[model samples]
Target: MMAAVATAALLSGCSVGVPDPAAPSNPPISSGPGTPTITPGHDAGAVAARDMPFSAGATLAHGVPVGLSEDLAKAPQWKQVVSNAGGASRYQKSDGCQVAAEVRQNQWPLVAADDRASTAALFAYLDPTVLPAYLKPASLRWGGERGKPGPAVDVLVLERAAKPTGQKAGRATVVLARVFGTAGSSVYVSASCPTAAALAAARADIAQWLTVVPPG
Candidate 1:
């Protein structure tokens, strides 16, 4: 239906970057229950990917968490969207911070047999030249903890910066995406915030899902 389709188009808040500037007070779109996906695991401290029954916003057994309404204090809970690639969910906290997540299939390899290349790719995010223009004033780094999400190549991009004194309404821009999937697929989860304080506020809830076991 038109109503259903209209709601599906909203963006998930997957990152440490700015997602939107105008909507400083609203969270991303969220809805729908989901099933978890399995990835390569069993010996790498990550359990084998498995499918489990999850409600509209439950923590995934192996994939990124979605549809988490209980975390938010009031109405307008997590909104979810599903498709062939995978699914995504978004939610906004009453305090103006928002979190979002997504899992999608890919044609190219994401978790390669030898993660050397993939590891390099994750490290590339730390390259100063590759970062966004706005991030020039900000400092970015990857999470120190490794051996997560099973045998998949993964990285949790982190950033810190002072509240912008120049940008208007604190344009949302930083999104530190982590892909947790198999060789060719990925799940992008992010906490998009307008300021450093906002991002810190949302970090605890967002990390609960993003830092879970399995690739995506």
Candidate 2:
């Protein structure tokens, strides 16, 4: 159920992972010819990490599961540079933008079972701690789609900094989502963008490119 919502949000190109009937809609931006693509240089360390195979009983990192999806592995324009036996993988582009995702079996009981509940739980966890550490106060907005049996929650965070005199301002955006499954399994996905425009252009495709498979 959570996966379905994430998939829909990605396919629909919605800014938020889930649709909000009351939220104002915006037109999609056009990516004309010569649009700069994110292409980050490869890291040898990351390449060595990808040599590890995904295995069962792996632990989650930053709420993401451990394992590479065929969809993501085969996705064009991205390369998996870091992977470990624990199921964590990092994808990078030439532009320094990157994404990481993973899957793991939950060790705790299902406290937040659906989207609404899971969103609440996630907000509580991220609001006082995670968001503040990364974003300016009141910079995060919450509201997307409701979760199903295993609800999926999505959040987007953006931070801006004034660049040195004469240089363009710097901006960064991070997109995160967690999808729950039966038997206490969950998949976490996240991406880091150097600019808001890059985040907007790539978030949906990157999210959609991931395919989560829970361990048996």
> In every candidate, how many clashes are there?
27, 17
| Model 1 lDDT tens row, 119-199 | 224324324233332221111112223234322223334343433686545323234443332323333445556667766
TM-score of each: 0.44, 0.46
Write model 2 residue lDDT over 31-94, tens digit each, in one string: 7775332224523233222211122112222222223363555566777776633455667766
Query: Lowest summed-lDDT stretch of 10 residues in model 2?
Result: 137-146
- Candidates' C-alpha lDDT: 0.35, 0.39
* RMSD values, in order shown: 13.5, 19.8
Q: Supply candidate 2's per-residue lDDT for 29.
A: 69
- Residue 22 C-alpha lDDT in model 1: 39
Q: Tally clashing residue pairs in candidate 1.
A: 27
